[model samples]
Target chain A: MSSVGAAEDPHHLAHGHTAAARDEGGIAPKRIVVSYGFWLFLVSDIIMFSAFFAAYAVLVQATAGGPAGRDLFKLKMVAIETALLLASSFTCGLAVIAASARDMDWTQRALGATGLLGAAFLGLEAYEFSGLIREGAGPQRSAFLSAFFALVGCHGLHVSAGVLWCGTMMAQIWTKGFRADILRRLLCFGLFWHALDIIWIGVFTIVYLMGARS
Target chain B: MTDTPPDGKRPWQNVWRSRIRTSLSYVDGLMRSVALATRRHDGVEDDAHGRAPGPAAALDAGGANDHAPGLDPVAHRASLIGYVTGLGLAALLTAISFWVALDRETFWQPGVAVGLCVLAAAQMGIHLVFFLHLTTGPDNVNNALAVAFGVLIIVLFGAGTLWIMSNLDTMMLPPVPR
Candidate 1:
């Protein structure tokens, strides 16, 4: 049968009439539509980060006879930054759980913790960047430094955005209560925060860890 | 409109009374409409005709515990476990990644890069499943498809750049003297 005919056929509905079929057919909830759109946005963001990763990988060896990754990387500091971010992601997950359970106080507390951890992570990153620049190892020094700064700085920027978003969400929940709209926003924030952590893992491994060794 | 009063009272008095009454009714109607709109937006109405509750119904439902369809406390508890598990695994993976990178003497130095990549991919998967709630159910199939397409694009972009650049590195340079 043709695709249109199949859609019209009652048999099609009978064989595992999943939620997607019903939602797509019409009457899909606002939450589903918004989240799907948000997911698309996240995917586009991942593509952009992937491009940055590719650039970093290509120029990793192009240090222009200046300081290389091994000369500049501080594994102990990066480890602390990684820990802060990982902890923040965990707390963000807890916030989501509290939101799902409709527990207002716990949600606020978890989100507050997540925000603090995220702030600490950003602070360490800024310190690291400033230190590197002070030592004349800034992005302008070499192609390798340029790519390194671009990749890590971009991830830091995302973390900064996540911190701002977390604060906004706390205010929204305070004023609006746990309304469905607020809940949807919370869900999106959780997704965004976790995705940032994932990207950081990539950055830590490829840029910090691998670069130091190579 | 006639200026003369219908009743025996003063014309201006009659006109003022009528105008005030009309404006009062208009204000009353406006208040009622606003109240109704708020109720509808509160997200309390049931999922009629397979529809999810609207946002305003949330307030009408009276409390956060009044979850809509498909969102219950039991499921929340289960998801909590998933989140904790994801957190623990992610921490473990991060530690392992650091260890492998830092301690070059333990593992073959050449394989560390590949090992780190594998660990990073695994951590990403854990986050996607636990934190992002990405899964294979019907409701999430579209999300899965979108993510899959994204991964394909990322792989193509990354791999294609490496391939082209490495080729250029070989072909663009003049032959080195023996």
Candidate 2:
């Protein structure tokens, strides 16, 4: 079937019969293409993060005899950050369930919760970055500092984007309800949000934890 | 608009047709695997079948049944709880790692540092598998594949860059002036 035909077929939307049939029959072109497309985008995102990680690793020791991670990092603060991000991921999963069920209110609530948690995480990160800068451990102080700022800042930027995306999705749910396009967007958002959480795990491990020791 | 070629002769048509054929083959292979796995486990019957003999016989013999065709709320809730718990645990682990790194004087020993790094990587895998649900399921195998490919590229490039640059710094850079 033509891609446009597959997308527009009301049969596909009616009780999702078409989708079920395609799955059962092992012939779902649209699903495969959509899946592949999302994967391609994910791969590209990973590449972007890899570049940042590489830079950070290269500059890990540029402290100029300044205060190192051992002195600057607050385990309590990082714990809070991790909690916020992880909670946001949980809420994100709830949002996906809501979307799948076509429960607009639950979906909006979950998305809002996700956004708030994500924003809280971002706020903590910004505060951490600022605190470092205030203590004269700014990115300008060392090569290590620069890489640290860039890598963590890049992640912070993604979290910010997720917040904005959640807010927009909430608005869309309110306006358009749980339409296919919106659900697709939400699925993609879920993937993106979870991917960030996975990457943050690396950050917590490599940059903060390991750097503190080294 | 003037004159379109026949469907069989159109280049775009041929390309799409071939793509569809290839995708069908892939799906066929996946379905075969699912069938084989299911068949391999088909002989196991639980005690529920033994206790409810009549009901079980009726079910086995294909009798009337009320089927609620909709989302499974309990499964959904269970999945949500699992994800929440996983995330919470990951957060706790991250905090502990940070604490150990900051407080323990011997934590920077090369072996210890490498162990810590490996722990972090394992934490990442936990988040992916438990929280993100990136695994080999009917709905998510493609996602899992994507993640695997992406991770491969990131590891190769990130580790390679770090290794090369660290070597360069040691060999090429002049000693720091006192």
Candidate 3:
């Protein structure tokens, strides 16, 4: 399908089916192209995270006889952060749904909810990091602490970037009013947001839940 | 356009809606998506029919037959039911993991950690299927290939590193295992 006039078709608007058959010379629809591109980027991102996961696994036991994750970790705070990120992901999905339907009002509301939840998660993470620093369990103290900070901090940085992207998207939608390019951007944002939540699943499982036990 | 009235005037539907109305409307929505996802194509073009995706569904006037018959334009809506169900399952998994982790004394030692791994994997699968819409559809072949390749590399890198590092640690310590 030609990307230019695809959306202008009334049937496409009503149905939103962008299926590209194998015979279509390998060119997917614009929506699928952007979404699939983002999917590859996410896969590469996961590969990068696995390196840190390996590092953390190897170094988690090398605490240099100081405080370990069991001694310094707080499960309660980590649980809260996980919940916030999960909720934000759901809200981001809702925002995408609303954007697809061209419901400006609900899209903005859902995006706003996502941003607030994400910011709250960041606030809690910052609080946890500062508390660790104050308690003399900072990253400089041990190899384990450094690995922990690098893995979790990388995920936190992604969340920060996602929140900023979401804000900019809200503004673009408000001004451009659901243009095709804007909608593609919205799709990428939704995928990115969901990808971050998936990574957090790994972070909490490996770093917090398993780390505390091991 | 296929939305049937909630009124259970049909003799069979009377029992159905009565039993179902106690729960939120999500049950019906879930069933609908399940139906759509598993719908049979049977060599006929599925989108070749004039079925429009249900969008603005509640607010849309019942002009269901405006399109010409057999005019199938390809497009699909991301079902809201799928997202809600994904969220529900993920939340359940998270709660269970936390409960297991917090009450370590209640369960066996190493089993809890392994259980957390299973739960995390389950939750990640849920997010991929529902939120990311990963599927076996023809258009998704390339995406699936990319994911499979990435997973292969990750497994090799992570497992290989752990194996070597653990062996190195044991050799370094030469501990009381002797």
Candidate 4:
């Protein structure tokens, strides 16, 4: 109604008016909007990881006459890594619980625990990589090693990022006093941390479990 | 008219003045248009931030003075239960996978492969439901949709790669004389 042109285009005006009406009625809360968007991003990330998984699956048998998974893998080390990662996921969930309750002390404690566990997992992984490299079974050794490092190493990078994010969230909550925005960020971090664990499960079963046997 | 600087000492004053005027007007016009576009869409006044009420804040505004907590405390407790269940299930699944892999000789190889895949899928579900809190409720439909789409893409990618690459391998690899 601001211009004669707007009046002339009744259909456009009507569409705009209806869209405004829908905004009033159908506007989602911020949590849903943010979480839904983040969920999509996580899904896209998983899709990218699937491409890597497919490559690894195809190349798993292609040791190129070099040492295979059974010759190189240490299941005990992998098992410990899995346990550490799983415990961290659980602690992350606890952090979410504490954050939701506005229990600052518990939230910090849980986040600290989660970070430590994540650090432990990364430490073990670094040790594994160093040992493997020491033994000359590094990524360049064979197609199998290449795929192995690509998949597991990518996961390690994510965990590293998650640890950093956890630390940042703790600092934010400490300084900001659990403001709503900070809480929202904490929720996002929790989702990210849990998604990493889900991906790790895939890595464990497919790469570690199946690879050793195959 | 003399084309001279207004200050009478600086030769570039007039030129600089014109340039500043042009830039200021440009910025003013930009601000006006942005204001117009953002003004009163759908009969509601847009806040300066132009953001809608988020779930937690909206609920807080609805007179639930105690809603400042991230979500319902009861729900948090319930989710704690979910976390425990998920952790136990995930741990059990990992143990089974390791057991199957380490034993190596008891089950048929292909059967073991199939079993591992199944266990992995189940563990992923536990994480999604328990850790991520993804559900099938109407409020969670979008999250569920995203997850389903991701699964579809992964299946297509993995299956397609295996099929095409395996076939190519058979054709390309030189046959060894037995």
DockQ agreement of candidate 3 with the native complex? 0.22
Which ranges of candidate 1 are over 4 A from the true structure? A1-25, B1-78, B174-178
The TM-scores of all predictions, comma-separated, are 0.76, 0.69, 0.76, 0.74
- Over A76-177, each residue of candidate 3 has an lDDT whose tens digit, in order, gives 899899989989988987787666556788899999999999999999999999999999999999999999999989999998999899899989999989
Q: Is the docking of candidate 2 incorrect, acceptable, medium or high quality?
A: incorrect
Better of 1 and 2 by lDDT: 1
The DockQ figures for the candidates are 0.21, 0.20, 0.22, 0.22
Q: Where does candidate 3 chain B have its weakest 10-residue lDDT segment?
A: B64-73
Residue B107 of candidate 3: its Cα lDDT? 89
> What class would a CAPRI assessor give candidate 4's docking?
incorrect
Among the numbered candidates, top lDDT falls to 1
**DockQ, structure candidate 4:** 0.22
Residue-level lDDT tens digits of model 4 in A1-214: 1232244455575654543334434656566678898899899888989999999999999988988987888889989999999999999987876665566887899999999999999999999999999999899999989999999999999999999999999999999886757867887898899999999989988888777776
Winner by DockQ between candidate 3 and candidate 2: 3
What is residue B39's positional error in candidate 1, in angstroms?
22
User: For residue B67, what is the lDDT in candidate 4?
Assistant: 21
**Candidate 3 TM-score over all chains jointly:** 0.76
The candidate, 1 or 3, that scores higher on DockQ is 3
Residues A40-139, candidate 2, lDDT per residue (tens digit)?
7867987898898888877777778877777888867877787788888888987876565455777888899999999989889989989898989898
